[model samples]
Target: MEILLWIIIIGLFITSFVALFFPVLPSVFAIWGGFIIYHFFLNSGELTTFFWISMVTLTAVLLLADVFTGSLAVKQFGGSKLGGRVAAISVIIGAFVYPPFGILALPFIAVIIVEYWQQEDFLSALRAAIGTLIGFLSGRLAEGIIQLIMIGWFFLIIWS
Candidate 1:
């Protein structure tokens, strides 16, 4: 029974990793939810202090990365503070509306819209929007790598 529960937890972790790219899923929280199940429900023995600390720390880091990268992307693209704010809101809206592509598209669209509104120039808006896209993609790549590492570490802990 514990093994079955563990498998389910692991599955959730995997799903969370994939869902990290989408704004709607809150990937760090999803992974943490799996741990919550294991800790509160299936865990038969106390986890090591090191294990607990690692898990919590990693989750917090991922959450911070999510917020920081997005805002940084806006700043990197030469966006105004208002643009960053709109990008944040667009991320929330993008998560629920179209998904996957929408996750990537909406932020770009939002940045471009705001940039154009502020700059009143198509070329400048396009440039900043492209920058936002590049930064966003970089962040996504980093998140994917981190999620892979986290999942790999989890597997090591479970199986070893």
Candidate 2:
């Protein structure tokens, strides 16, 4: 039973990392799931209140980072609000379309099409698309780092 519980916790942690690229997965929740499992099943009150509070704060930061990075990047490149929305939607859709590669390609293509349609300029559309790609990648990188920190913090608390 102990081994099984550990496996489940570890799996959840791994899933959180996977969620970095696959927008379909709830990355933060998956991470919380691991901590919750450990708190309830394995250690029972082992996690400190400070730990929980910190985790919650980090979660909020992670979410904000994701939204801001994408929107800011798009806007910085002259992409409109509509382009940002389209890029976000494309990310989710891309998750199901062709997987890993789709996640990258779909947003780039979607942003270009939407921006071009709205701006009526190919060069401007391409710029926005490139911005979307950069933003998406930046957001993912931030998310991955945060998730890693969360997991590392959990381990440090538990093991030490």
By TM-score, the best candidate is 2
- Candidates' lDDT values, in order? 0.74, 0.92
Weakest 10 consecutive residues, lDDT, candidate 1?
42-51
Evaluated against the true structure, the overall lDDT of model 1 is: 0.74
How does candidate 1 fare on TM-score?
0.85
Residue pairs with clashing backbones, model 1: none
Writing each residue's lDDT as its tens digit, candidate 2 over 73-144 gives 999999999999999999999999999889889999999999999989999999999999989999999999
TM-score of each: 0.85, 0.98
In model 1, how large is the Cα lDDT of residue 89?
A: 83
Clashes of each: 0, 0
- Point out where model 1 deviates above 4 Å: none
